[model samples]
Target: EKRAFLAQSPQLYKQICALAFEKVFMIVPVFRAEKFDQPTHLNELRQMDIEQAFASDEEVMNALEECLAYILKEVREKCEEELEVLGQRIEIPRLPLRRIPYSKAIEMLREKGEEIEYGEDFSKSQERLLWKIVKEEAFFITQWPEELKAFYAMPYEDNPKLVKAFDLIYRGLEISSGTQRIHDPELLIKRIKEKGLDPKNFEFYIDCFRYGSVEHAGWSIGLERLTMAITGRKNIREVCLFPRDRKRIFP
Candidate 1:
């Protein structure tokens, strides 16, 4: 029998910690076996992950917005000379950033004459076009289609077809993504089955909720992606000292 190899994401572990700690944050390495090579993608990277118990998606998004704005402000104030050399300007985005629903985003794209479907994920070009249309340096796309998100994402109370999830887009690139996770064990199991996944494999995670659990939402920011956005770098690799992608792995 072939042994399964674990890849790093910190999704499950972070949630587990949130159950006990109420709020937690970590900067950790992540690994993915992505097949495609893109300027913004890497097989291995660092992520800043945060999870908070008794929090809704809206609250989590607000926290992320404030955190990102503070980071940019600090960079702007402390690294003026470095930014000047790079010809980069860090603009602190306004609070409570504009949120465009997934459905509305699809409509906007269609209006712009882009060939796109409602349920499909956005391509890189589509993301850039959306930035152009919105004319915002940073904003959020929220309430994604349920099928497009992970099984752990909480379904919207009003619409089962959608999830309480959001993505932070900066400079036409996704810097972070998050969701209000499903806390009910029954619902989690149901979602797992719906996704054609074996719940047995997730017994450890589900068992944690069986005892007691609170509502929680979390998000992760890709360190390299965030750096690229702040520095106005065209490629994520420009910010990462040792980038690992499909084509290159060695330092």
Candidate 2:
């Protein structure tokens, strides 16, 4: 190992934390080295990474909903001017949001003359297609097949084809992705292998299961993306105080 990538967010760390503490949340900086350009695509961003053990995916979504609701309640009560500018005024969204599977979303898009391949994730345009119908939604679509999700998503029952996963899409953009995780050490290793990655890098993570771990799940909500949405900003850079992009860096 010459050089290694260090996580800015406590994603992997929190998973370990959940081993001892079943429910934990962290609002931290996450450094992503990919080239950035879109208003929402910054090289470095603030991420609210959370994972809960001994909980189901639905429970995790409910928790995230509660957190977002509390934030909005505070903002509306205090940040009147800001909310006025954004033209957003709201309280808690309903209990359950609209949950559509990737396969169904694809079919709907195809009806709109968009031929999509199975197992492929949605592109911006594809998302917008659904957004038009779900514009006023705070709900989520779940059960993206394992192939379309990260290795961490737990496989769904009766549907070994799909994973127990979901994305919180609001105002047409993905705000959060939460799902149950593979607690079985063997399954985690199998997932890692299926993704064509070595298991060595994740040895430390795998160690959690080797010891004793609980069955918990959690979701992460991108902070910058939330800012852009809440502020009604078209470009993501507008939300960040000092946004760092691919071509723009200085203040």
Candidate 3:
């Protein structure tokens, strides 16, 4: 039998579309092989993705904030009764959500006695603690270390150690992540090699850029996780109709 795998994410497709179409969005199912059996870990979930050519990380972050705020506003106005039934009240977040640098976040965490290291990804508890400090319903953690982000993320021109990336944390959970991609084919290859991945494997992806690619940025939002944030659900499975995780796949 041949080994097969499901689509883990629409990242490649989105980038390709951005190169050709300038802008594109999709709501699709994504699969993950992670073995995490936690309240927020789902093997199969829905993702809402968007990509735009000639855009920066700040531009995409603004778009994401507006998109989320609009959704919450609509829910608050139209789903009042439904929210009442669920004993929840959705708050429309203010525009231009707070942006915190990764370094600053790490410093704040350390001050709060969190023994977290500088290049480490934030744990759920750390995220919650960050929420307590910022006290904002939604915010962006930006400029993550390049080592922690995907190879495609564009490194800062002044400081190559950090990448132009951001993660939107809503109610202490990372609902979306985005970055300005490296449009230069050479840079793409270099980043791939730096990540210990053979550039040959990403030949097709790199080839797309050789034909004159433009700078682009995009993001993906997990539908179930967003639902969990909006509905105040403790578990992501509660928001998913047929949640798939490490266990319980049957109806």
Candidate 4:
């Protein structure tokens, strides 16, 4: 935890594996210093990260989505007793969930009488509004403003203003955000600088790219969020086995 700030996903893992393995999937506990004690918010949670080297971000998404589809189905079949006890039913979505873009989501929101500017990221109330209408749409939203996403997401070729990033929204909330990662050392440094983060602090990561790396893409899902999606809980805390929040530190 000291050396590696709990990465929201395996962004570094994918980059490291790109040097050797063509494909890598790492599932681990990621720690996020979230501010709230919301139902889905946890300081420590499980994350499933899958990355593919030598593949376009689209292909990576396809692989990731396929893997999730299979796993969700398998869990429903194998964990019938558990689901029954929890009063939950997992609906396995089909391959190729619909992809939407920020521009369209804005338009849809505007049509519903919301006031929002083009440059801003979605606020919590804004996301709630989205869920009110989206209602069970298992889809991804891509081509986000570069400023809105993390530094690692690949910027678009045709339009540098937008990144090749995508966020998966299940039911209504954002479950995961993924993209083609920045592999070029110089470009990554530039992005880090632009994001107002210190490159020196991330030197250990910088060192890895100097040896060998490739274009890679992957994603991380919030375990609590996934559980809430499975259990139909609006607040994130409801799905956790033991709750930890900003207000409560001890069990």
Work out the TM-score per prediction.
Answer: 0.97, 0.92, 0.97, 0.87
Which residue window of length 10 is worst by lDDT in model 3? 242-251
lDDT by residue (1-251, candidate 3, tens digit) is 98877999999879999988999999999999998888988999999999999999999999999999998999899999989999997777888899999999999999999999999999988998998988999999999999999999999999999999999999888999999999999999899999999999778888999999888999999989999989998999889887788887887
- Higher-TM-score candidate of 2 and 4: 2
Off by more than 4 A, model 1? 1-4
Q: Mind sharing the TM-score for model 4? A: 0.87
143-249 per-residue lDDT for model 2 (tens digits): 78788887878897787779989988766778888788888899899999999999999999998888877778888899999877677778887888887767766
lDDT of each: 0.93, 0.79, 0.92, 0.78
* Model 2 weakest 10-residue run by lDDT: 89-98
lDDT of 4 by residue, 119-209 (tens): 7877656666776766644777788999988888889889989998888877677777788988888888999999999999778887887
Q: Tell me how many residue pairs clash in candidate 3.
A: 0
**Positional deviation of residue 117's Cα in model 2 after best superposition, in angstroms:** 2.1
- Top candidate by lDDT: 1
Model 1 over residues 1-251: C-alpha lDDT tens digits? 98886556999989999999999999998899989788889889999999999999999999999999999999999999999999998888988899999999999999999999989999989988999999998999999999999999999888999999999999888999999999999999999999999999999999999999999999999999989878888888899887889989887
| lDDT (Cα, 0-100) at 173 in candidate 3 | 88
Error of 2 at 204 (Å): 0.9
After superposition on all CA atoms, what RMSD does each candidate show versus the true structure? Answer: 1.3, 2.0, 1.2, 2.7
- Give each model's clash number: 0, 6, 0, 4
Point out the higher-scoring one by TM-score: 3 or 4. 3
Per-residue error for 237 in candidate 2, Å, reads 0.4
